[model samples]
Target: MTCTEEAKAELPSDARPEIKAYLENFNSYDTIFIGYPNWWGTMPMCMFTLLDKLDIILYNKT
Candidate 1:
């Protein structure tokens, strides 16, 4: 199952489409620099989701 499908299952009707579109275009960057302050001994879920959705093939080929 893709992230879009999984995200849709968790989110409500209105937000699913935008979230899916973000994930689909998430791989457009060649290199991403994620800078986030650790809060309560944990990074944000959004960062993890971005990393999880990125395509590894772009790095491997370069």
Candidate 2:
């Protein structure tokens, strides 16, 4: 839907998208699932951002 790299996640940013309140219980789950449409042989930039942030969150807690 976009033809530019200026979009988020394509580039890292301090801003993070809002998460659902129910998802606050993230650690309660034993398994996590991720789904995204394949775009140009890469995941959407938002996935990159989410995964990057998730990694940081996981790292900080442990």
Candidate 3:
């Protein structure tokens, strides 16, 4: 709730926060949906943290 406000301010800095969720076989999944709060015309920096942790090179090609 309150973090949204803080995240908005931190977006400009491109901060990659360490997300609490973890996936061992990220690449094994055939499909994955990435949903996030859109602030400042983009996803939160926390999204980048999860994205960066996942093997997203071959993800979502449509």
Best by TM-score: 3
List the pairs of residues colliding in candidate 1.
none
Per-residue lDDT tens digits for candidate 1, residues 2-51, read 85465544444223122254534445766667797663355444555545
**Candidate 1 regions off by >4 Å?**
1-28, 55-62
RMSD of 2: 4.6
Off by over 4 Å in 2: 1-22
Order of all candidates by TM-score, from best down to worst?
3, 2, 1
Model 2 lDDT at residue 44: 65
Preferred candidate (lDDT higher): 1 or 3: 3
Task: Please say which candidate is ahead in lDDT: 2 or 3.
Answer: 3
List runs of model 3 lying over 4 Å from the truth. 56-62
Instruction: Kindly list the per-residue Cα lDDT of model 2 for residues 1-62, writing each as its tens digit.
Output: 35454544444554344434324655566788999978557676667667776676666686
Better of 1 and 2 by TM-score: 2
Pairwise TM-score winner, candidates 2 and 3: 3
Model 2 clash pairs? none
Question: Cα deviation in Å at residue 56, candidate 3?
Answer: 7.0
The residue-level lDDT of candidate 1 at 18 comes to 27
Model 3 agreement with the true structure over 1-62: per-residue lDDT tens digits: 78878887788888887777686776678889989878788888888878776636455644
